[model samples]
Target: MAVTRQLTGIQVRGLLGRFDHEIIFPESDEFIILHGPNGVGKTMLLELIQSLSGTLRIPSIHRTPFSEVRLTYSDGTQFEVSKALQETLPLGEELEKQIQRLIFRLRLPDGQEISSTAGFDSEELASPRFRDWASRVLDLEPVGPDIWLTTGGYTISSLELLHKYSDRLPTRALRTGGGKVDARILAFLGENEVHLIETQRLLTLEDPDSSEFRRGSTRTPAVSKVESFARDLTRRLADALAENSRTSQELDRTYPRRVLQAHTEYPSEEKIRERYSEQNELRKSLSAISLLDENVGRIEIPKKMEPWQRNVLWTYLEDTEKKLSTFSEILAKVSLLQEIVNTRFLYKRLEIDRRRGLRLVSEEGTELGLSMLSSGEQHELVLLYDLLFNVQPGALVLIDEPEISLHVSWQKRFIEDLQRISRLVKFRSVVATHSPQIAGKWINRMVSLGPGTTD
Candidate 1:
């Protein structure tokens, strides 16, 4: 079953330098724009919110000690996660190594809390309070020092005191208003629903023949960008052609050789009689292959093309053409190629040649490489393609600095274009930008982040 989950809001405390205590209001609009001046930690706050979903793992050095994040879902359920750094005693001058630990607590509507802590001492699992808490919340009765807790379909064995729930509870009790508790927990952990677009979103398309063709600081080859949509279209076309070839092979194998000989020239009565017998034998073989009676002769081995067969073949060809046309239509709809072609005379059409990569044909019959496009145009194309083809529906998309490389006019229409694209893709987007032109008239949907801001 597909569940519709939306992030209502998030509260962070003592996480980063700027965000001592911050409350982000993301529920105001499906599309959110976070705009602020430089050094305000706008990008850091975005990263921290993304990390809280549990999809991204922060490095130990980047991880802050004594940080708490509370995320509220649309269903009123809350996920509260906190991390702390613990240090042991040192012998002399050298300090002891610090261990970072995490804790998870699920808050229900009835005021009940399901809590578990990781990185605790192994001996602590033997404590009576820990066992009682496990039995009540995790539904586990610990018999020994080592125990496992089964929650939300996954087994939690990190704590030695945790044990799997022995009794099977009612299905209704296990599920919250939205869905299963496990699914909610997984959703909070950024399972398949979070998409993070970093500030450095530009893709470098390096020309193999000339190093001067490379643009940007990155010198990555062209294969990375080409693999995105071009490869998928190629694979689909290959599969379709393979299917057609298989069908042709099947027809050839089932065709009778005697019928071919009879049709090669005008047949005499004797020759016709002999071919008729061969045809009967051929029918028998085909009947056996098709699991039908010999007399049925359902598999027609035509000596010559009939009018009805010609019509059928033409219809099949038309259907194949329609399949290819449909693919082109989908590509045109999802990408900005058609819009670019319609407005700008830069290209007349966009096509993919098997020998060459993506090609743009101009009005003057000139084939232009993708690398020939300006940086702004390339950024626009790549961003649209990634949004349309890469991200899934209902995903929380976090884009950093969308106005980079875009013209002032394009920046003004950025939110509008995003809104139109969202109609087809159906994703919740939170874009961080410094340009007021990008925000435009959507100021009501905008959230401002300031330095040393607290909730």
Candidate 2:
């Protein structure tokens, strides 16, 4: 039997000064179409489900500050979540602390009230099934830290947490082997891959599958390889310097003043020469100089880093490993992200080749490869890339406005493709568009965003 999560009704509280609000989700279709103009809280409604399910959340940018997030279903199953948002006070005062704190609350069907991160205990919150829902699905994840939460689904926030269970991971551990935990999480949330985009993106807590490598290198991380090279370089430089310093001081009175490195035998030879010197003054100076230089040589940094600097890699690796292994879904996203990056790379290659074939590549080379293609073709390629980011099946997608850059024919075709993509990946989708052409050619079931009425 096909797994389905029927949305009967929902209630939200502590959000945008809304103590409580009830939304009756359309029951006929598997997707929920939240219609609204620019300012309405259609996106906010979508984020609520994500927060409750441990999926990522797209924080509100406009008005209606999302303070509390709560939801309820037809069967009275509900989820309560609390969020804390506010800047901290410079001065330390207990009473002023509350001013800097914002909290959200959600009530689930079982009467369980969830507040902020502190409100839910990890022991009670960790569920193997949530891990499952997020695995193998695609369609929702943030392009950057600007959007919090990594899982993708409805509202660019809600995780159509995959309810389906498979043997890819263990039922209790919910992870394959800690190597792909992040990918596993993506699979459950209806997205099974992730991509790291933008030039000079931070390597902090980033996955290793990013396809944008240093042109041609092994899949090994750029940072790791560079670090190794630096270490070897440091050692070689230090050795060469030390050898020169020792040879310089081994001369007689008329000997040309030059530095020489201390060979392994230099320590014993220097003792013998000092005993036979006319005065101990020159001998003491030479020995002292050699000692000072040797100490400096000892201070030389590793080829890649200083000891202090290298320590960061250790700490970062430890923390990343601990946090990453807990979520098996992340592995799936990392795999998919690699594919997305490769696609972008291919697009770039195609553009470069097209431009070199004799055309004005100056004023027109805005986005490199993207500039060579027609707008429609570019949009289609971009859509495919976006779709690949969420490669897992059985996901629920809510699209606010899909006709932004599409044409009349593309609107219809894209909608059909969107429908087809869901079937291939096992997902459910809802789209909102203002294009009358799309409306005429496509869907008939649309929930209007006009003023409220008891329809």
Candidate 3:
């Protein structure tokens, strides 16, 4: 059974230019689309949601001194996260007056609230009375005017200490929300439930079953973009290949055992030799084909030749190319047979080779590498693959631009294809596109963002 989780609404103030929008998602399976021009806060809105979900760090691009975000989940759970900069006190009366402070607050579910404040004044941060207060509230003993807890503890200046505390204060508050509620919120905000597919083509050529993918290396940036999906697919494919290899070995062993039994029952040395010779010949033919197939992409015709000779060369090259194309198409069809069935695209094959990486083959057996694909085809393949394989059911997928490289015809079918894929995967999506063709007939779900608009 698929888990159902939804973001009902969000309210923001002083964050990325005062965005205040209530996104009431459809109770049905329909997804939302944020249509707007460039420079609007569409991507910022997605980042804010991602931050609220605790999956990403708060963007440093926010120039505002204070910001607040409130989120309402489908389960009636609510969260409000706020951050305020430390103010400066008047120079003359600073010692006599209360110091200015930076404040961080979080209002969790069940009406419970947690708040933390850090003073800006150096004297206040060093004072024994203030140290006692910190000890009581934050459980840290002051070792020196600039250090806290034990001698081996963090040895930072007063200002840096305050800043560090303020930065992590929200996470601390989350910890205090009662174990069950805290766990639930963390799970809800986890990467598995919230996916953000940024607009960048990051790919690297390496073995899929290599240690890099298995141990989750950061050297591959594209892997991080689709981390969970890549990890899961890598494991599944590696296991499947290993199992198939084992089955083949088992069959080979069984064949010898069967032959030995047959020989004991009715032995014939000439018959055995003839059978072995035939099998050897078959294996040699297969080996030759495999070697030729591996080098198909490198095959090139000579430039300097007579017309008739060139024609002959062209015929040979064309036949070889046809065989290679058919081989690629067969591989693709076998790999993505199920996906092809669901989407019904003219693309018959989608292959993620251990060595070659991703490739697409048309129904007519035209094979193309990822780089060789047209812009529209690349966009369609990347988006569809991410939606179908990466995103989990009931999760919110934030797509930046679905129509960037799509043709008008493809743009028109974009929403329809997305809707079909979403239904099959049981996930929800919020797409940000500028093309009306991409928005299609889902205008009811569209929220347009314009210049100087709060919502």
Candidate 4:
């Protein structure tokens, strides 16, 4: 994974014209939990962060009323997004008008600051030209005001629709009209990936085209995403095997030549046997996970061997090591997923099957359907899968209300499990929760957002 900049802290003022928050993330901590009373703007702060950090959603940003927001990054760069509030918005069509008063400013570590007035063309969004083009070209069916049914049968908001079709749309449609200056700023913000896992944990949170939503479920079953993920994992394993096969064949074709060119000096038989033993153990691990089809049969190693025999054995082991290295990352992810999930499951165990990617088998020897899992179980599986597979390295993951539908015990273990995952996945997390159990023992890492308080 490529290294990218991460958010170090965020400051917001005049949130809903009353709440102010300044959240500074711990430099070394894997995650930060925001806790406070209801209606204190915790979730709104997260949404503000999401809208400004990545893939700018103009409508959503406007929907979230705020005076000013400043985001500081690990690289010492900063972004300040503010808007002019002329009048209080009323409900109905009158509120849909574009204020066109947003200002975006980017400040670099070197002290250079670039600013632009960024706003979307509301006319284009409401125009029949764009609507007809979207429906005809993109296959998006207009289901409600500012809502469209994606080809997959799931609904998407107009803000998301504009984002999905931004590249192919007209230049003046959503661009800030600041020409190259705004374009550069948008591109810069786009580089910093930010994912928001909202309070709607049961529904699919990502775009419509994601593997989970592509199954054409109008009302997306949360468990279907898990099942689709299993199938996707199987495909990924097959691709990895194919990659290993290609690499092995190429190595084998040149095996004799490479061995012939090798030096005569060889390691001691004990050392050679040790390396062979390590490689065999790796094979066993892979086979146990169904990543490898062939069994790892026991090998008889001679206590003593000729120099030529040692040379051949060492070469073979090196080749085998290269072949197995392909699965190293994939194996770690799958193993961790299994370990965490199986430990939490009460009566079932998760097992990887080459044919099905993964399966839950009950103690009674019956295979359980992915959809049969309870809501809390589905939340655990889906959330973990997204964090492990969907999110990119160095991205900011904002999880809202992670304790929803989760058992109190599970909530207590949430932070520990997330910390373990963060260590392996190297990303920053900012979670908003109303439950004290989810906050756990990390008192120093908790930022309490209260009415009119800035912390």
TM-score of each: 0.57, 0.38, 0.53, 0.83
Error of 2 at 67 (Å): 4.8
Better of 1 and 3 by TM-score: 1
> By the TM-score metric, which is better: model 3 or model 4?
4
Candidate 3 lDDT by residue in tens digits, 305-379: 544444443343333333333334223322343354225435555545443334456777788544555555555
Model 3: per-residue Cα lDDT at residue 97:
35
**lDDT for residue 393 in candidate 3, whole number 0-100:** 67
lDDT of 3 at 250: 58
Error of 3 at 259 (Å): 27
lDDT per residue for candidate 2 within 1-455, as digits (tens), equals 33344445555554456435555556455444444444445555554454334333222211234555444444454444344544322222321332222243444445664443221111211343322233322212433312213443333211111111111112232221223323323333232111212112112122322212122222334442222322333343344335444543332222322122222322233333333232233223323212222122112223455344434333333332333233223223223433332343333322111112211122434444324555444444444434533334444455545565565666665555565555445555555555555555434455554345223
- Which order, best to worst by TM-score? 4, 1, 3, 2
Question: What TM-score does structure 3 among the candidates reach?
Answer: 0.53
Clashes per candidate (backbone, < 3 Å): 4, 81, 1, 0
Model 1, total clashes: 4
Candidates' RMSD to native: 17.2, 24.9, 15.3, 5.6
lDDT at 223 for candidate 3?
41
Give the Cα lDDT of each candidate: 0.54, 0.36, 0.52, 0.77
Among all windows of 10 consecutive residues in model 1, the one with the lowest summed lDDT is: 161-170
Report the lDDT tens digits of candidate 1 across residue range 1-455.
45465777767666454455444555546787777667666676667667656443333212433377777777677877776544332222222344345566788666777754443232333446545545654456554444344544443442212111212211221112132334445554664376777766554344222112122223345454534455554554455445545655555564444233323234343443454465556445323223224574223435665544544433333333333333342443434544642353344555544333245677788877665666776667667666765667887788889888888888887787777677677888889898878988887777767653221
- Please provide, for model 4 over 15-61, each residue's C-alpha lDDT reduced to its tens digit, 9 standing for 90 to 100: 98898888898557678989888888988898888888667666567
Location of the lowest summed lDDT over 10 successive residues in candidate 3:
209-218
